[model samples]
Target: MRLLKQLGTVAGVALAGNLAVGAAGGGWVASLVLGIATGLLALLAYRWVVRRTERRRPVEVELAGARAGLGAGLLVGTAMFVGVIGAIALLGGYRVEGWGSLTGAAGLLGVAVASGVTEELLFRGVLFRVIEERAGTWVSLGFTAALFGAMHLVNPHASLWGAIAIAVEAGVMLAAAYAATRSLWLPIGLHIGWNFAQSGIFGTEVSGADTAMGLLHGVTSGPVALSGGAFGPEASVVAVLAGAAAAAVFLRLAHQRGRIVARRSRALATATV
Candidate 1:
C-alpha cells in the first residue's frame, strides 16, 4: 500500500540520516536533524504520490499561508504566554529566575523553528495526508494527532495524563496548523511559537526537557496533577484547553472559506479512481 511505503520512507530516512551523522556523534542533535529531514522527505514523497495519482500538480507550500500563519500564530502565542503567567501567578506557582541571554533566546528560537518545521511536515504534512487518502480526513487527523501525542510518552517525565493532554491539546494545534490555508506552515508557526514561549521564554519545562535558556526560569511548584511534572507544560490541562480552543477558531474560519471538505474529498475520489 502507498501508506505502508510512506511509513517505509519514514524509517529509511531516519536510518539513512542517522547513519550518516552517527559517525560524527551528533547524538540527539543528529537524530533530530535526521528525523526532521526524514519527515520533510516523507511529505514530499506523499505530495508526489498524491499529485500523480490524482493527476494534479503537487501543491507548492504556500508563502502567503506561511506569512499569515506566522502573524496569527505570534499573536495567539503571545496572548497565551501572558495568560499562562497570570494563571501561574494566580496559582501562586510563579517565580522569576533572573535573566536569560540573547544568545540563549536565539538558540531557543532555533530549536523552535527546527522542531516545528520538522514535526509539522512529518505528522501534519506527510502522515496526515497519506492516511487521509485511505482513511477519511477525520480519521487521519485524529489518528495522527493521537500518535503524535503518544509519541511524547517516551520523554523523561511523561505520565498517562500528560500523554492524554498532549494528544488532545497538541492534536488541536496540529490540526489547526494543517487547516490554516492547508499549507502546513500555520500550524508549524503556531507550534513553534507556542512551544518556544512555554519553554524558552517562560523557562517552563517543555515536555519534560529542561529548557537551556529563556527570559524567565520557572519551576513547577504545584503537584504533578496541575503542573505536568517532568513532562513539562504540555501535560497541563491549561495548555490542552488553550491549544484546542485556538484550533477550534481556525477550523471555524477554514470552514467558512469552503476549504474544509472539498479538497480532501476530491483527493479521496482521485485516489480511488
Candidate 2:
C-alpha cells in the first residue's frame, strides 16, 4: 500500500507533465519551460510522497550531492553515446550530412529533461529502491530492467530485439548507477544526457520514436545490428556492449561500497541466528 501510494503519486505527476508538454504545442521555448517545470514538480512530488509514506528524508534526492552527481552522470552518459556513435562510424554505419534545426533540438531538450527526471524518479527512486529493500539488489535490478524494456515496447519503432537491448543497456546500467551512488540525480542526468545526445545532438531517433531533426544532420546505414535500424543506435550491438561494460563498472562500485542488498529471506535467516 505504501509503495502503491508513492508510485501512484509520482507516476501521476509524470503523466500530467507529459500531457502538459504535448499541450504546450510546437514552440521550443514553451516546451522547454514546461519541461523544466514538470521535472521540478515531479521531484517535489516524489519528495513529498516519500516523506508522507516512509516518514523519512528521501536521501536519494537530497540536494547536497545533486550538482556533483548530475554533473558526473551527464559527462559519463554523453561520452558513452559519443563513443558508441564513433565506433559505429568507424564501421561505416553513421555519418554527418549537414547542420540540423536548433529549434528541434531545443524541443527535444525539453522532452529529454522531463522524461529523464520522471523516469528515474519512478523507476529507480520508487520501484527499484523499494523492491531492493525486500527482494535484494539482483532481483530488483532484473525485474525492473525487464519491465522497463517492456514499457518501451509501446513505442512506434519498438522491436523485440530493441526491447531486449534497452533492458540490458539502459535498464540495468541506470539501475546500477543508482545503486552505486544511492542517489537519483546521477541516473537522472545520465538519462537526460543519453536521450538529448541521441536526438537533440546526434539527430537519431530515440527509442524508435520519430523525432524532429536535431542539431546535426546525422545519418546511419549498414546492417540493423550495427546501425540499430529504425529503432536507432540504442539497439545496436555496440550500444549493448558499451552499456554492459558500464553496468559492470557501476555494479562493482556498488559491491565495493557494501550497498548490495541480500535477499529478504537470507537477511531474515541471518538475523535469526
Candidate 3:
C-alpha cells in the first residue's frame, strides 16, 4: 500500500510536469526552465509522499551525507565518462568535426540536469528504496536496473546491445551510487555529469537522442562494436567494461558499510508475531 501510494504520487507529479513543459513549446531556454522547475517540483513531491506513506524522519529522507555524495559522484562520474570517451577517441573511433553554438550547449545542460534529478528520484529514491525495504538490496538493484534499460527500448536506434549496455553501465552504476551513499544526490550528480560530458561536451548521441550542438562537433567512426554505431559509444565494449569496473568498486564500498539489506524471512516474521 505504501509503495503504491508513492508510485502514484510520483507518476502524477511527473505527468503534470511533462504537460507543463510541453505547453511551454520547443525553445531551448523555455524547455530548460520548465525542465528544471519540473524536476524541483517532483523532488518536493517525492519528499512529501515518502513522509506521508512511510512515516520517515526528515533526516532519513533528506540524508545527512548528501553533500559528500554529490561531490564524490561528480568527480567519479566525470572521470569515468572522460576515460571511456577518451579511449574511443584514442582508438580512432571518434573525431572532432568543429565547434558548436552556446545555445545548444546550454540547452543540453538543462536536459542533463532535469533528467539526472527526476530519474534518480523516481527510480532510486522511490522504487528501489521501497523494494529494498522488503525484497532486499540485491533484488531491488537487479529489478530496477533491468527496468531502467527496458524503458529505453523505445528510443530511436535502440538495439539489443544498447539496452544491455545501459543496464550494466548506467542502471547498475547509478543504483550502486545510491546504495553506497544512501542518498539520491550521488546518483543524480553522476547521471548529470555523465550525460552532459557525453552529449554536451564531447558531441555524441545519448541513448540515440541527438544532443544540441555541443562544444565540439564530433563524430564517431570505426566498427559498430567499437564506435557504438547510431546508438553512440554507450554500446561499445569498453564503455560497458569501464562502467562495470566502477560498479564493482561502488558495490564493494556499500558492502563494507553494511548497506546490503537482506530480505526478511516470512517464517521468522510469522513466528515472531
Candidate 4:
C-alpha cells in the first residue's frame, strides 16, 4: 500500500525525468542541467510521498544535518579516490602522460554532479529509504546495492567483474554511508567527489565510459587486478579494499549511533506491539 505508492512515485518521477531530458537532446550542458533539475524534482516528490505515507516532518527532507553530511562526504570521497589512485601510481602501475583540456574536465564535472544528485535521490533517498522501512537495514542494503550494481551492466564497456566491483565498492559503501548518517547529502557529496576525482581530476575512464579530457592525463598499465583493466581504476583491487575498509568504518559509526536496524524478528515484534 504505502510502500507501493512511494515506490511508484519514485519510479514514475524518474521515468518522467529521463524521458523529458533524453527527448530534449541538448549536448552535455543541457543534459546536465536537466538531470540536476530532475533530481531536485525527485527529491521533492520523495519528500511529499514520505510526508503523506509516513508522517515525517519537513525538516527531515530539508536542511537538517545536510551541512555535516556534505562536508563529511566530500572529505571521505576525495580521500578514498585519491588514496586508491595514489596507491596505483606509487606502485608504478599508473603514469602521467601530459596535461588535459580544462574545458573537458569542467564538462565531466557537470556530468558527475548531475549523476551524483540524481542517483542519490533515486537510490539512497527514495528506494533504499522506502525499502528499509519495510525490510530493515541489511535486507534493504543488500537489495539496493545489488540493484545499483546490476543497473551498471548497461554501461558502455561493462563486465561481470566490473559490476561485482561496483556492487562491493560503491553500492555497499554509499548505502553504508547513508546508514551511518541517515541522510542523502553525505552519499551525494561522496558520489560527486569520487566520480569527479576519478574522471575529471585523474583523467581516467569512469565506469567504462569514455571521459572528457581531465586535469591530469595519464595511462594505467599493470595486471588487471591492480590496473582495473578496461573498466578503469574503479575495478582495481585497491579500490575494493579501500571501499571495504570505509564501509566497515561507517558501519561501526552506524552501530554506535544506534541507527542500524535489527533483523526482521525484532522489527516484527515492534510492529506487532
Candidate 5:
C-alpha cells in the first residue's frame, strides 16, 4: 500500500506535467516554463508522499548539498556524452552541418529538466529504494534497470537492441549512481545533462524521439551500430560500453561504502541468529 501510494503520487504528477507541457504547444517559452513547473511540482509531491507513507523525513531528496550533487553530476554526465560524441566523430559517424537554433535548445532544456527530475524521483527514489529494502541492491538494480529499458520500447523508433541498450546504459548507470550517493540529485543531474547534450547541444535525436535542433546542426551517418541511426547515439555500442564502465565504477564505490544491501532472507536469518 505504501509503495503504491508513493508510486501513484509521483507518477501522477509526472503524467500530468507531461500533459501540461504538451498542451502548452511547441513554443520554447511555454515548454520551458511548464517543464520547470512540472519538475518542481513532482519533487514536492515526492517529498509529501514519502512523508505521509513512511512517516519519516525524505532525506534522499533533501535539499542539503543538492546543488553540489547536481553540479557534479551535470559535469560528469555532460563530459561523458561529449566523449561519446567525440568517439563517434573520430569514426566519421557524426559531423557538424551548421549552427542550430538556440530556441530549440532552450525548449529541449526544459524537457530535459522535467524528465531528469521526475524520472530519478520515480525510478531511483521510489522503486529502487523500496525494492532494495527487501530484495537487496542487486535485485533492485536489475529489476528497475530492465523496467526502465522496457519503458523506452514504446517510443516511436524503439527497437529490441535500442531497449536493451537503454537498459544496460541508462537504467543501470543511473541506478548505480543512486546506490553510490544515496541521493536522487546526482542521477537527476546526470539525466538532465545527458538529454540536453544530446538534443539541446548536439542537435541529435534522443531515445528515438525527434526533438528540436539544438545549438549545433549536428548530423550522424554510418552503420546503425556506430551511428545509432534513427534511434540516436544512445543506441550505439559506444554508449553501452561507456555506461557500463560508469556503472561499474559506481557499484564499486557503493560496495566500498558498505551501501550494498543483503538479500532479505539473509538479513532475516542474521537477525534470527
Candidate 6:
C-alpha cells in the first residue's frame, strides 16, 4: 500500500514538475519535460517529514478499490463531456477548429494523465489530507476546493468568474469524487474528462489553452459574453450553471449512499464522546 501510494505521489510530482518547468520561461516541450521530471522530487524531499506522521504501518490498499476508482473516473468523464456540450449548445454559435492530428490526440492523453496524476497529488494527496487531519473530512474537502479554484487563476484564459466557478463547481465536486473512491481514479477522471471535453470535443479553450483543435466552432458576436471571449468557455456563465448542476448531482448521490462527510464527522464525534 505504501509503495503504491508512493508511486502515485511520484507520478504526480513528475507531472507537476514538468508543468512548472514548461511554464518557467521555458518553451512548451521544455516545460512539459521539466514539470514531469521533478514533481515528485518535492515528495521525496518531504518523505521524512511525513514518515513519522503516517498511521499504523501502511496496510495493503485494496486493488478492488483502485479498480473501482477507474470506473468512477470514467463516469466523471462522461458527465463532464455531456455537461460541457449541453452548456455550449445553449450558448449557440459554437464552432470547432484547431484540432491536431493523431499525434496531437495522443499528446492530449499524455496531458490528461500528467494533469490528473499531478493535480490529485497536490490537492487530494497533500492539501486535502492535511486539512482533513487538522479539521474534519468535510472541511478538508472544502478547503481543497477553494485551493483548486485558486490554482485556475493561473490558467491561460482564466477570469475571476472562471476561478470562482471552478472553486464552487469543480473544486468541491472533484474533492468529493476523490473522497468517494479513496483511489485517485475518480478525481483524475473528472479532471481529465472535464478538460478534454472542453478543449478536445468542444474545440474551445479548456481554461485558456487556446485549443489547436476546433471541435464545434460557431460564431459568437457579442463581447464573448456568450462564448468565453479570450479566456475560453470556462469563464462563461454557462459553465457555472453546468458545473453547479454536476456538483449537486454528485452530492445527491453521495447522500443516498450515506457517504456525505457530515455523517462521517458525526460518527467521529460520537466515537470521541
Predicted structure 6: clash tally: 32
Clashing pairs in 2: none
Candidate 3 structure quality by residue, lDDT tens digits, 146-171 = 99888888999998889999999999
- Local distance difference test values of all predictions, in order: 0.66, 0.92, 0.82, 0.81, 0.92, 0.60
Residue 29 lDDT in candidate 2? 84
Q: lDDT per residue, candidate 6, 30-124, as tens digits?
A: 43455334533543423533464564322112344556665667676757666655656665736444344443444444455556656666677
Q: What is the per-residue lDDT of model 2 for residues 1-273, given as tens digits with 9 covering 90 to 100?
A: 888998899889888877887786757887778888889999999999999988999999999999999999899999999999999999999999999999889988988998999999989999999888888999999999999999999998899999999999999999999999999999999999999999999999899987888999999899999999999999899999999999999999999999999888876756754
What's the ranking of the predictions by lDDT, best on top? 5, 2, 3, 4, 1, 6
Query: Which is superior by lDDT, 1 or 3?
Result: 3
Pitting candidate 2 against candidate 3, the one with the higher TM-score is 2
* Model 1 misplaced regions, further than 4 Å: 1-60, 262-273
> What's the distance in Å from true for residue 62, model 1?
2.4
Off by over 4 Å in 2: 266-273
Task: Name the TM-score of candidate 3.
Answer: 0.93
* Clash count, one per candidate: 4, 0, 0, 0, 0, 32
Looking at model 3, the pairs that clash are none
The TM-score between candidate 2 and the true structure equals 0.96
Q: Report model 6's TM-score to 2 decimal places.
A: 0.71
For residue 108, model 2's alpha carbon misses the true position, in angstroms, by 0.9
Candidate 2 weakest lDDT stretch, 10 residues: 264-273
For residues 153-253, write the lDDT of model 1, one tens digit per residue: 88887777887887777775677557656777667667777777876687777777776667776667676655666776677666777777877877787
TM-score of each: 0.77, 0.96, 0.93, 0.87, 0.97, 0.71
Model 4, range 131-197, lDDT digits (tens) per residue?
7876788998899989998988898878888898888888999999989888788998899889989
Better of 4 and 6 by lDDT: 4
